[model samples]
Target: MAQLAAARQGTHSTKTRAEVSGGGRKPYKQKGTGRARQGSIRAPQFTGGGVVHGPKPRDYSQRTPKKMKAGALRGALSDRAREGRIHVVSELVTGDVPSTKKAMAVISALSLEGKVLLVVGREETTSWLSLRNVPNTHVLSPDQLNTYDVLVSDQVLFTKAALETFTAGAPTGKSVKAVAAESEVEA
Candidate 1:
């Protein structure tokens, strides 16, 4: 939940009476007026008045411990793997630019449905762009992988290079060499 909460964009804002303009003069006399007292036209009671106790812009981000975050990510991935939803593709070859047709062919070949999270290695722009136009598909580098995305995705597809990078030094008990060798065989 922390990760999901932090992902929210807290851009809401509301102006207070002090922040509202054109309220310098008193709306009415203090004693003569039978109406309720109001210091400025920008008071909450006025039609165009500033909001009272309304939302304010703030940062929703929260800091999670590095170990905790890693643990959560590992747990999520482990669950997906246990459920047989994780796929390791030998490669994600794409042309110089985005190609929705190629992406569709890959998806169909893998029989992936629902939301698919594609993990790629650094500087894999062609592969990333290729999957951009594919609906329900999202591309991210190994560094950008998070527990939320892993859990939410119905299928997690990792390129050979990305799988190696993602599993490097991870506590999954699978050595980088083993993963690389497997990917090599697949290639």
Candidate 2:
């Protein structure tokens, strides 16, 4: 089993070159084809290149068995718990459009200072309106959960509903199976 890494506790996993794609075979032949001596069809000089099968748009998804996902989630949560980097509240009640004041109050109540990624079972326009203006604070749903976002934020606030939703794939819930330890920057 892969060591469960947590963004909060300084443990993070990065994708290996294999996970990326490209390098499959040689480009063209070294003989007289009037064209530049190539190696295989996969050469980078061509439309594609002599790279092993370069990164394709396939699923970069890692196969973490059901238990692993659960374990990883638990491990991540446990890491946060150990560091007290998580704040779980019963609900994330915001006004119709999400008043920043209310959102600020929530942070104040939780005493969650610094960058925070507030996770909910689902994103709401109100919360969006409220937290969007904040520099480091951002809201996300379970499905939108990813390693980078979790890592960027100093803390993760999971509402009870969101936690339940993450644990169970319900009609309204989504899964956050990716390792939550990456930066938001696109790979």
Candidate 3:
């Protein structure tokens, strides 16, 4: 919920009478001939007046407890896993450079449809570039994973390294470095 709220761009704004331009002087005298009281043209009653009770820019971020956030993520992943929507792949390779053909082949092999979330332990440029163009496919690092993305995706594909990172508990610098070292040895 916090992630979803933060995603919203609350940039809406409105100009008040003081902020509106070209309303420095009064339009007419206070006592008018068969006319209502007069004020600045920027008054709300005027046609070119400033907005009233208008929206303003604000931050929609919510402060969720760390435990609650962790629990929610675990629950989401558990639900998906129970539903058999989580697939753990041995590895996601696309040669030394990114290749759309290789990425497409992998997607086809997995038979992934709709929204697919591919989680990786590290930021591999080749993998990211290769899968970026695939429709309905999103490649994200394990640390970037959240309950919203997990729940929204039709299928969640976790690379072996990513699975290990999750199973090892919260991601830390030491753990990430260890994972990288392991991948290097394997490669």
Question: Would you list the rank order by TM-score, best first?
Answer: 3, 1, 2
Model 3, 52: alpha-carbon shift in Å? 1.1
**Maximum-lDDT candidate:** 1
- The model with the greater lDDT, 1 or 2, is 1
Top of the candidates by TM-score: 3
Q: Across residues 55-81, which tens digit of lDDT does each residue of candidate 3 receive?
A: 989998899776677778777777776
Q: How would you encode candidate 1's per-residue C-alpha lDDT over 1-187 as one tens digit per residue?
A: 8877887899999899888878889878898778888888888889878899999989888887776777777677767776778888766765577676776787789898899999988777778777777779889988788888988899989887888786664546542311222322232
TM-score of predicted model 3?
0.82
Global local distance difference test of model 3: 0.75
Task: Give the clash count for each candidate.
Answer: 0, 31, 0
lDDT of 2 by residue, 1-187 (tens): 2323322243334333343255555544677788776554434455543344443333333455655655556566556656768777776664465577777788888888789988776545566567767887888887666545565678888776666665554354364343333221111
lDDT for each of the candidates? Answer: 0.77, 0.60, 0.75
Q: Which ranking of candidates, highest lDDT first?
A: 1, 3, 2
